[model samples]
Target: MGGSSDVSRRRFLQNAALSGAAAVSGVGIARRADAEGAGGGAGQAVDPRSTEASGRVMNPIVPDFAGEYGGKVPEFQVPKRPMGKTGLQVSILGMGGFHLGSAAGQKEVTEMVAKALDHGINFFDNAWEYHKGMSEEFVGTALKGKRDQAIVMTKVCTHGRKKDVAMQQLEESLKRLQTDHLDVWQVHEVIYYNDPDKIYAPDGVLEALTAAKQQGKVRFVGFTGHKNPLIHLDMLNRGFAFDTVQMPINAFDPSYRSFEREVLPVAVQKGMAVFSMKSMSGSGEPIVHGALTPTEALSYAMTVPGVSTTISGMDSMEVLDQNLMILANFKPLGEADMNALREHGKQFCDGRYELFKSSLKYDGDLGRQQHQFPTAEEVPA
Candidate 1:
């Protein structure tokens, strides 16, 4: 009996050694744990694991923005912006997932995703049609086993007032994302005159979205528009509650076609999360006109009140790292930083709204006729 007991103890010790080695090698074991939701629920605090089973190693860097202003960095250095009136707190800098699917390969996509998560970016944005749904796939893979670590937001762009079609699209998105629910589900790519009436018609997209929320498949509902603030406002006022609104909020935007002046305040007043996009002067044109450096452009956007988050397309690891650094070190822009950026960017706004002018690059839905609103002539003038 004593000899048999000694042999069993030796066997158990050997098995334990092998298990520890496998965990250190980053084998499939840790991934399984994460997928099982072993750590915690979404947005729960994370404890960095230092074993090979941790899958990918992430470098966490909090930028020293407060240092530039002669102030001590707060213990919670990353600013949390509220998502509309919902009282959901999100990182001030959000990761734009559109380019992640469109413009990146698997390796680049995975690296970017890991880096963003490491850098405290909780808000992630994606669209169903982006990269033919490759974006969602990449995100799903990168976030595998780590779904509870961040807030995932995605959009759908199906046509018509067909509830079934909308529901199908939503399911497709969920499958692609490998998630049971989304933090925010947005009506993607809204443009001129399509009004809430058409979108929220009898069997409309809103019905599907509301149903999803009720089912715990989505937490919040919102909309995004790159054109016509009036359309955005109309959609908001159309009766259904929206938790968030995304629009073009940039320095050049204020000079012409000012969503900042007209629409942003409305969103803030309505207590909806205000997401800002087109901060790079829409289509990356501002860089050519010497308007602002990429860092300066992001900084300017960060300073805006009611601007919950600024989403930027990060296709490359370098771009991802650069953005992470900027956001990590993000200090609220003072008068000097703000004034200099505005002055430097003034000359670029010479009646050339490239995004609106060149319909080919920006307006992919123009040919569909689904987005068209009634012209003044058709409206019985």
Candidate 2:
């Protein structure tokens, strides 16, 4: 466990970064990775902490996965960065909201949130639809007296509904999060093809975003989606101003239809706080399938230049401790190393690891119902 042996793991990562796995034709195992992790599916209440990491569907690219796999939790402070043009300094890492509901109970959520705050995490991501409002409730209870210490954000799931629906959801989100005002309020799951049109229509959710800010109910407003890059682009091109944008970012993203490649630069150019999610391929498929180590996946996502914070889900203390340990020994991957990792990810770039884009698997049932799309069971991917 000494830092002296860093070279072996680093070298192994280098090899994996440059590797293409088993070539594009050898994509069968990738499918199986999707299947094994697909049981609970996405947008569900699966505890992210329970993902088993040691034995995987495939052998690792290298056998030197010793040090990064498990390590002592460090008490050092996690780093912070500027939140785009918002002028607020937030932790480079954020605590995802959904997993809070999936945690064992209120005690676990309390511990995880407390630990996250102690480690300098100030940005918390949540949505109105997550865990049937349980996620927001847990985050609310955990942050009772310490509200001022965190930058709380939750999405209003209007989903093509009228402005009134957005407003109602906002009020409920406030009640569930136990806050009178939110640091950030976002339009959740702008995934459907006509989302932009619907949101920009007369008396749409965009108006709600404006009214929320004007009424001092929210400080900033933005939107989030993990679908096509074009959908995000469409949202950006529309007339309304957005304070932030959230999307999936990972090593595998650069090789495929990439939000980093297409939308990230635009959001950065617009001076929006860019929050990254799905750093571990939405459900740790790459790690569980031995495609990339957790360190490599997280490092790549956080290392992306324009990212304000990388939001990762931790349903148990173990996952949180692992993340803390990674941050303690953190170092950015160089541009060349990033490219190598992207090249390595080309093998699984077929959308197996990042199922949010590939299938309707990640879409929430509410969103599906709103969009008139199929259920999670119908399209399990």
Q: Give one digit per residue, the lDDT tens place, for model 1 in 171-254.
A: 999999999999999887676475466687887888888898999999998888775677887887777888888887666666
Candidate 2's TM-score: 0.85
**For every model in order, what is the number of clashing pairs?**
8, 0
Model 2 gets an lDDT of 0.75
- TM-scores for all predictions: 0.74, 0.85
lDDT, candidate 2, 1-381, per-residue tens? 213133224433323421232221122112111111112354232221233322332223223222343344657788899999999998989888876666788889989899899989898988988888998999999999999999998998888999999999999999999999999999998888899999999999999999999999999999998878999999999858999999999888887889999999999999999999888766666654556756677788889999999988766666676667667777777776676677677767689977888876677888787888777777655
lDDT values for all models: 0.60, 0.75
As for candidate 2, its clashing pairs are none
The segments of candidate 1 whose C-alpha lies over 4 angstroms from its true place after superposition are 1-77, 343-346, 350-360, 366-381
Could you give the C-alpha RMSD of every candidate to the true structure, in order shown?
A: 18.7, 7.0
Q: How much lDDT does candidate 1 score?
A: 0.60
